[model samples]
Target: MKKTLLISHNREKLLNALVYFSKSTRFCGKTKLFKLLYFLDFIHFRETGRSITGLNYYAWDKGPVPQDLFHELKQPDTDLKETIALLEQSEDEDYRLCRVIAKKPFDPKYFSRREKKIMEELSFVFKDALAKDMVEITHLSGTPWDKTMKEKGPGKRIDYSLAVDGSKGSLSLEEIKERMSEIKEVTEIFGDQ
Candidate 1:
């Protein structure tokens, strides 16, 4: 039997669709379904204060915000400062998507098991580079980091330090992701060493 989380609004329609979708041979895992439901819940919560309850008894109040819900609620906005404050105070884990993905509302756990395994392999490769002093990692956590980044866009801000080598003067991972092609173009204009 497929697990389901039923929200308050559009119950009959959503349930009917979910039932049909669940029977498909192409159906993905419960995690994927949870993600969709979670996002819907977040939109519901933002538009109205009520969170999705009664989904096979897996409730946000009882545990971490559903991964999809966490991702949806973390998007950047004009009220990002206030939203971040609300998120920090809530049950969601403080996932620094800006650092990892250069976007808000990233959920690593949303990836398929195979995809996550590939990411783990890539992570080890990157970690090795850092260990050999070829790359550096930096981490930003807590309110101070959030405040700084809020004032300065991710492109121009450095929030947390994971690894740094002053000799290289390279961009942080966040910056690299944010300005991938731009960095190359700018460097070409300035002439590479």
Candidate 2:
């Protein structure tokens, strides 16, 4: 599928987010990391009409997943090469678990105030939650992932607009359309990077 997001996936900011979550929370595994980014992007989009990461999430069995980033992290020589590393830790080892390690310092300059605030909140709230805990949260009924899985089937792209009108959404239908139009205009002008 084509990367239709107008704003390119900001790798620098993503790396920083990873670092921030790694330092601020204990459950920074591949699964939990994806959920955090999902909330960050979807919540931000629900409020502002744009996603922070410029990523399209898919309805994977675990929940909404940024599949591109997922694949890259599972292999070597991706964008995050030196910026971060995933350290395997036994789940039962309470004292020695750290799934992700930041090789670079966190960069706050790449994030906006709202974005930073949301990340901080997510880190704090999910600090002790297990990866499966996040999975359950994202899989709750009426969520974009849940809705998509039921309506569009698995592997389908979860639309950002759903965050605006799904069960947790607060915006009206017309407002959502307007914001989506504006976003489309900006992306059309900028095109895909």
**What lDDT is reached at residue 35 by model 1?**
33
The 10-residue segment with the lowest total lDDT in model 2? 1-10
Query: TM-scores, in order shown?
Result: 0.22, 0.84
Q: Where does candidate 2 stray beyond 4 Å? A: 1-9, 76-78, 92-98, 166-169, 191-193
lDDT of 1 by residue, 75-178 (tens): 53332222222211222374211211111333343334443343344334333232112111111232222333456534332222211222244344555445
In order, the Cα lDDT scores of the candidates are 0.31, 0.81
Give model 2's TM-score versus the native structure: 0.84
Q: Which residue pairs show backbone clashes in model 2?
A: none
- Candidate of highest lDDT: 2
Clash pairs, model 1 backbone: 5-55, 137-162, 137-163, 138-161, 138-162, 139-160, 139-161, 139-162, 140-160
Please report how far candidate 1 places residue 75 from its true position, in Å: 36
